[model samples]
Target: MDPASSIVTPASVPDPRATETVADLADQLRQLRLAAHRPAPTDNPLTLRQLAVLTGLPHSTLGNAESGRVLPRVEVVYRIAQACGVPDDQLPWWTAARNRVAGRRRRAPHPAPPPPPRERRAEPVPDQPILADDLLLELGGTAVDKAAELLAGRAPESVVAFLQRLHPALVAKLLATMDPVLATGHLSGLSPQHAVACLDATDPGTAARLLTLTPVTAAVAHLTAMNPEAAARALAVMPGTALAARLPHLDVDLVRRTARTMPVEQRTALLTGAPLPPAVTGELLFSLGFDGSLALLRAAGARVAARLLTALPADPAAGLLAELPARDAAAMLKQMPAEQAAARLLGMTDRQAAERLAPLSPRPLGDVLAHLPVPCAARVLAWFADARRRAVLQRMRPERAMPIRWHTETATYRLWLPTLATEAATSGATSAPTLAELATAGPPPPALTPGTGGPAATG
Candidate 1:
């Protein structure tokens, strides 16, 4: 194929300032070559390949120069122009393209030279068995505490395996010699059982002091893995006042999980006594089954239960209320702040709200309803029999009664009454319930059982 015939000059002119920039210089050079190579009606123009052959340079050199990817040397430009039969009169254009590219390079910013590479310090892992003290000093490098930090960052299993090869007494002595805070980090990396074993072998005072120094997470992990009797003995000897203060400050979730295996009284003491935020306590309780959480909620006393309830969404709160004895449910509701309880109940189904609120005294129940969205409060009143509805209405203030009645009467006309106060109340009170709360209203989808497509087929 003849490349020269296929080359169509683009209609758009190159930017006038293109030659001022290196990038534009290259582009301008390409356009110049194409312009120079355009054929006259009487003569066949040379293609880039033919010109390359005549100039004793690769075709790519001409193509790259024409495409502006790379600027050609002045001599190469002169040679391409001469091969293409560019007249001597037009030779200065080729020189100008080459000079523009070179000039741009001189004006462009120059990057700073890179810095030389630094020499690295050697870290050699010993192949042969070494004495405990020597290995400790070598790994630690003049600081026993820093050694603990370094070793703690290694894989937990690897650290434990490395320590197991040493004499037990020597391990105890090494741990005892280091700052307790630093030793806590190294001990935390070990399996809880192994950590417990190591601590048990140390001097009782030393072991207790070290345990106190450990973070609650590491201490709980180790203690939980120990046999109950062994754990109790260790706890009995620890400096009780300091350990007790520290335990309360430890991670609440960790303390909650560890408390499960402890004696009932001890577990209760740990969880109830820990300074856990009410929100965390509610989330933890919600993780348990309906029965377990109910039991804990009951035991938490009215004030704490009220605090926890405010953190839960409507459905789970309703589910909890459904499970509790009427007396306990009423007590929890009475203890709850009127505004929060009303907000939560507004999201509940009419029946759930009715059943729970039916037990409450008139004054408290009226206060709760007054705080609820008009639609939800009206819905609850509608759920009651005529006698109960009038009783509740009679007890409510005129301000509360008027809104509830207005919402109930305007229920079907809500869309037409955008300016009505009840419409705003309905829209403002629509809190989206969580998936867990929604799940409580219906059974979960069945889990996929092994060796079955779904439920077993009936014969």
Candidate 2:
């Protein structure tokens, strides 16, 4: 079959009708691809064999997909995305487009279902009519009307209060029912504290995810409004590095402070990610060498300093790098992308620089690994002497055990030894969580398991 004449035949006896359904599904995909303005990759993202191997659908499936014959299952749709080397979310948009198509397959427009009667949630106000106009605009009124809402009102402020207090899903519905652009814009710009209050009432998980879309200021405002415990829990679920990565894009200072008290990965993410004035970056590095600076950063009580090292510049970054005494900086730096770590390599003293640069050895490998994640620096070196940890405790500023334990507990000894250990063995350390093991979802490292290492066993 000439590839140009796109058509498909399933392996079984050709049922023109079934092929037509598959063909229809394929056309839906094609239309969606066009609508999304997708361009074909320079190299075909799918090979005939690979696509068949992954989807278990035939090459004919592609043709059917291009045509209008077959509808892929949800997994098949994901497989199609995988085959094309695109994210899975791209498929759902097509599914939505197809759903719209399905809706259009009406039997006979059975007199458009009568619009549901409006519920009287609040009494109508005189003069200041509370219509959708308050939310939307006068523009062409048509587009705004079509966008988010048709609201405008002089209803008692209590009505706006009620809407504000509604659950997020209900808010989604109310907003959806109103003019889109107007409602969304208004919701987005609402007071941060109020947003946080509303968000707190929502599942923390959902709120954490949404926090990315909302302005950073808004996130801070909402978090400020939330009780500390609730704010902390929401922050706990979000890794620091992940949050920090977005900080550079934010035009807010609060992002830095907010991330200061988060766990390692999350903090690392924020530090490495937030774009900074070189002066700020340098100052941040200077602080990494100072005890009180880090303490103050984490005083907000969410993310702490240890996890945020990845976010710093080379001088400050290296300052923090040298602080990981008990750990192997080389080992952790080995885990990092060399490009990020290499920048720090340029400034330090010979011995200090050697410890950090040792990871870049093995020539070609170092060059290859240089582009890896930045957090691997401190993490790789956690196997060193307790003296080093003490140095960190001191260099970071004679801080007590609680904050140190709060920040750098990734090492096995970090968990059980100094902080959590009994004073009779008083290495003068922090107290550890009493859980027999680390609270992890998967199995812990064998070295950290019972009796694996002496200190680990003791802890």
User: Which candidate comes out best when scored by lDDT?
Assistant: 1
Q: How many residue pairs clash (N, CA or C atoms closer than 3 angstroms) in each of the candidate models, in the order given?
A: 0, 78
Query: Tens digit of lDDT per residue, candidate 2, span 273-313?
Result: 54554433433334333764444334422223333444566
lDDT of 1 by residue, 337-365 (tens): 88877766655555456667888877788
Steric clash pairs (candidate 1): none
At residue 209, candidate 2 shows an lDDT of: 56
In terms of TM-score, the best-performing candidate is: 1
Clashes of 1: 0
For candidate 2, give the lDDT: 0.41
Q: What is the C-alpha lDDT of each candidate?
A: 0.57, 0.41
By TM-score, how accurate is candidate 2? 0.32
